[model samples]
Structures are given as C-alpha cells and as structure tokens.
Target: MARVVVEVMLKPEILDPQGQAIGRKLPQMGFEGVAAVRQGKRFEIELAGPADEAAVERVRELAGTLLANPVIEDFEVHVAE
Candidate 1:
C-alpha cells in the first residue's frame, strides 16, 4: 500500500479572510504574540498499490485538476512507500 499526503494552501499574495478572522479573535482570547495566521487544508490518501513515479504524477494531476484552484491556491503531494 501507498500513502499520499497533500497540503493545500492559499497563494502568498491571496487574501486569507478566514485566517484574518481567527487572528482577530485571538487577541480577545488572550493569546498574545500571534502576529499572523493562515488557514490551510491537508489530505491523506491511501492507494492499494505500490508507490511509483507514475502514480505520483497521476496524483499531482488530480490535485491540479480537481483538488485545488491553480489561480489562488497551490498544493504539494508526498508519497510514501
């Protein structure tokens, strides 16, 4: 079996409203030294086959096509044997 880990994050230039909202509330919750915060998504997928370069490429294509928005977000895929 193979395990794939995917991390999705907004582009650096993109505005993260959700993160901003949480950052705003942190001060009121007495959490100091929180200068900035950004929200992101992580996905783990398990495949019933060996981890290979072709499988990794297919996973990357899938992420680019359906999992993340290429314009505003980026994704990284890690495959483990």
Candidate 2:
C-alpha cells in the first residue's frame, strides 16, 4: 500500500492558545527548560497501489483545499517512504 502523509500546522503569525497552555503547564508539572510548543495534525492516507507523481499531486491538492485552511493554517502532502 502507498501512504500519503499530510502535515497541517497553524500559521506562524497566528496565536496558538493550546500550545501555549501546554507550555505553561509543563513548567508547573516540573518540566523545566521547556520554551514553547506548537501543535499540528498529521494524516496518513493509504492507497491500494504505489504512489505516483499524479497521485501525490492529487493528494496535495486535496490537502490544500479540504484538509488545511488557507487563512490560518498551512499543509504539506508527501508520499511516505
């Protein structure tokens, strides 16, 4: 099976409240030296056959349009080795 991996993350300029919360809580939980945190989504799409150029391109298009929001998030789609 072929695997297409999609990684989605918030834009750098956007504030990440959840990440900040984690960052804050870690220090209180005795986890020091933690500076910052950012959270993201990873999607693994399995196909019946090997990933080709066209298939990767299609997945990239799908990720941009349906998976990640253009206004607040960015995404990358690639074939998993």
Find the candidate with the highest TM-score and give its number.
2
Report the lDDT tens digits of candidate 2 across residue range 22-63: 999997899999889999999999988889998888888888
Global lDDT for candidate 1? 0.90
Question: Which parts of model 2 have CA positions greater than 4 angstroms off?
Answer: none
C-alpha displacement of 19 in model 2, angstroms?
Answer: 0.5
Judge candidate 1 at residue 16 and give its lDDT.
100
Expressed as tens digits, the lDDT of each residue in 1-81 for candidate 1 is: 899987899999999999999999999999999999999998888877876888888889888998899999989999854
- In candidate 1 the C-alpha lDDT for residue 1 amounts to 88
Count of backbone collisions in candidate 2: 0
Estimated TM-score per prediction?
Answer: 0.91, 0.93
lDDT of model 1, residue 79 = 84
Model 1 spans with C-alpha error above 4 angstroms: none
